[model samples]
Target: MSASSIPGRLRRMNKTQKLSVAGISAVAAAALSLSLVPGNADAETEPQAISGAPVIFASAAGASQAKTIQSSVIEQHSTAEQLIKASDSAKAKAVSKEKAKKAKAKAHAKEKAKAKKAASKRGKQGASRSESRTPVFSNNLDGWIKESLSIMKAKGIPGTYDGLHRNIIRESSGNPKAINDWDVNAVNGVPSKGLLQIIKPTFDAYHVGGTPHDQYDPVANITASANYAADKYGSIDNVNSAY
Candidate 1:
């Protein structure tokens, strides 16, 4: 079936018969080329369409990775929040502890101040008691005599101003420093000293409780002499001797 002989064969046939011959020749040419052409071997071997499972698996893996990343971020944020809360709690505890310490210190200081004030008050009360018991005015001779008289009165010793003055004039001429150095008392190593001219041993043996210990002191000498006179002669006014 060459293409050059097909036109010659159609020229010998009638109109209707030529149409049938041309149709059959067209069919025969198509059939001859079908056997001579190569088949689609590579296309038949290759897959026609893709499956849905691989695309679905890829989408799931992407979603899981995104979820993991989001969870990591959320965990980190939660940890940070926990740390902040813990820090704040520690700070609050520390502040409370400091305030408590300050309050305790304040209470301790107040207690100490109260104790000091109470001690001071007790000392003042003691001083008041002492002043009421012994009402001494001045440190002079007259003041000392008056103060000693108060003590003597409390002890029930009897004496008068006239008797004490009369004896002082006769003994020392009112000189508080008068001494009998050439007398028998001086020879016996017990000198007569002060206003009343009393010996050292007699003055000491009859020393008044609230008077000065020195025999040369005027009030001390007068007080000791009066006390001795009260015990022996019963009163200072009855003493007419060198005693």
Candidate 2:
């Protein structure tokens, strides 16, 4: 069997037994050589047994062992190939998933940027519109009348510059603080006041929105009186008398 066991076995045997085993091994080697010869017809016959040990076909045993080792190696190689295929498939799926994630993030970032840009554009446009619509008026009759007319237009109250001017000139001669303290309205304890000489009750009744409530306020006085005259005489242009 093993080389280490051979020395131990020889040490245990007597001198005659050792000689007998050696002689048997020699005869067995010689017989195997003759069996392998090309012209020997006994090559196919069963080998003769040695006296102290069983006959062994070393070549056939080595070939069968080599075949077993080769089969094991082939099986291991096939297993490794299958493992490699599975690993490659997993890697491919992971790579595809990563690519899709990156694409989705890129699309989301692009949409966010687009929305931010649109919001910025809308803010700029709104600022420009606010600046354009802002009006600056001087503190005078012309400015006051124009401002009141703008408010009147917005409120759907009908009146014209010529009509308002004509009535204001006749009523208080364009003086915003004008007051008729000695008239019948004054005797009644409610004096006619402001650019249109409007009594307190009449002014209160026809007060237009968007103007200050003060009777001395030019725009307020004019718009309120104009609103009253428009309701009664169709327009301020028709009011030429004490009305």
With a 3 Å backbone cut-off (N, CA, C), the pairs that clash in candidate 2 are none
lDDT of 1: 0.80
C-alpha lDDT values of all predictions: 0.80, 0.87
CA shift at 192, candidate 1, in angstroms? 6.4
lDDT score for residue 16 of model 1: 72
Model 1, 1-243: lDDT tens digits are: 999998998788899787666666665565555556677433334223432222222478898999999999999999999999999999999999999999999999999999999999999999999888866558654565576566667777788777887888899887888999898878988888888898888899989877789988878888888889999999888998776
In model 2, the worst 10-residue window by lDDT is 48-57
Per-residue lDDT tens digits for candidate 2, residues 21-65, read 788878877887787888876447676655656455579889999
TM-score of each: 0.44, 0.67
Clashing pairs in 1: none
Candidate 2 lDDT score relative to the true structure: 0.87
RMSD of each: 19.6, 9.6
